[model samples]
Target: MPDTPHLAAQPALSIFYQLLQFRDQRRKGGGMEAIATTLTEQDMRDIAAHYATLPAPAPQTGGDAQKIARGQQIAQQQYCSSCHGAQLQGQKHVPRLSGQSHAYFVTQLRNLRSGARADMDGTMASAARSLTDEEIEAMAAYARSLP
Candidate 1:
């Protein structure tokens, strides 16, 4: 709980500013847009630095068993483990859902559910489309309960 949200969001804001600057420069006949479209080594370094600074969410335990079971059922039905791993530890190019901040998970899930977050494969968006808000909450809770 060292206010990781503020620190994590800074890079996102910086990226947004970088995008705006690139757009402005492109409008002025600058080729920054092409460069900006591709993620540079420095951009990857910056992102890695920010991720390293972030503390993993606090470990959770002792949630309603029935709700967790139901959530697990939904997860299985949707084959969430295919990308998230058997324990939700996450796979390459996928993010860890278990042990993530509840607020963060909720926001992202909502975005995915609503098609606000543009996913490349659209897998998450399609999975989320079938889930109700209550199911999302239950899923989040179940994930939080895991290590």
Candidate 2:
């Protein structure tokens, strides 16, 4: 399962921020500066907390269970869980692979493998080095099978 609450809240922060702005701007001519000053750490945390209630996303892909199995082997051998989490559902700052499109997964892996995509520390790039295109496809298939 994913940290759905955080994922859900990440996209809605703008709305909560805007509400904060409105509440803070009630005085001082409603200036942006005043609104900025009015925003407390607690206020931000409160807004972020709203999304912690969302449910996890559903599984997105099916078929070729063998490909998924092979992908699992590759992922394990590559030590992917060290960063992406044990299930590849992602952790803080890492995007979930479970429900992503296969094309997206393949493209990202290809880019990362080739250094066309930017990784925070080149870890993905290095991990992707030994992956063949077929392996990438298998990994994508496997990732889609996760919940």
Candidate 3:
């Protein structure tokens, strides 16, 4: 069962939770480790293949229109559209910002600003550094409004 009621709403997170459990099991150095090591290379490859085949997540379409409009303006001013698509759909290694939960999005932005997040090539860190909490909140709101 999900640890929290909200967690049950995000079924996709089960994959990450399972991965963390697998890592913890390996670290414990006992029966769990044995099970972790039992996965054949082919099995790992198949898992990766399946992940690659998963469909792209649908863009989010739920938010207050006023908040979304404000966020859009903030994103443009912040140059977020330069890296994330103009629609916040993401590109290459950059993650899609659209459809992410507002809480999760805000937390990531805060982490980036605080230097707690390890971003590729330091671009996100630099971008985040210039954001005030209000801007971060606006960005999250805007990103979650895309569809």
Best of the candidates, lDDT: 2
What is the C-alpha lDDT profile of model 3 across 74-113, one tens digit per residue? Answer: 8888789998888876655456677666776887688778
Candidate 2 residue runs with Cα over 4 Å from true position: 1-54
Per-model clash counts, in order, read 0, 1, 0
The residue ranges of model 1 lying beyond 4 angstroms of the native Cα positions read: 1-40, 49-56
**Per-residue lDDT of model 2, residues 1-147, tens digit only:** 221122442224433544454455531222444555666757765754565345545566555989989988988988886767678866554555665567757876887898765555567689899999999988988877877
Please list the Cα RMSD from the true structure of every candidate, rounded to 1 decimal place: 7.9, 10.1, 7.1
lDDT for each candidate structure: 0.63, 0.64, 0.62
lDDT of 2: 0.64
- TM-score for candidate 1, residues paired by index: 0.66
- Candidate 2 lands at a TM-score of 0.63
* Residue 125 CA displacement from its true place in model 3, Å: 0.5
- lDDT, candidate 3, equals 0.62
- CA-RMSD of model 3: 7.1
In candidate 1, which residue pairs get closer than 3 Å at backbone N, Cα or C atoms, i.e. clash?
Answer: none
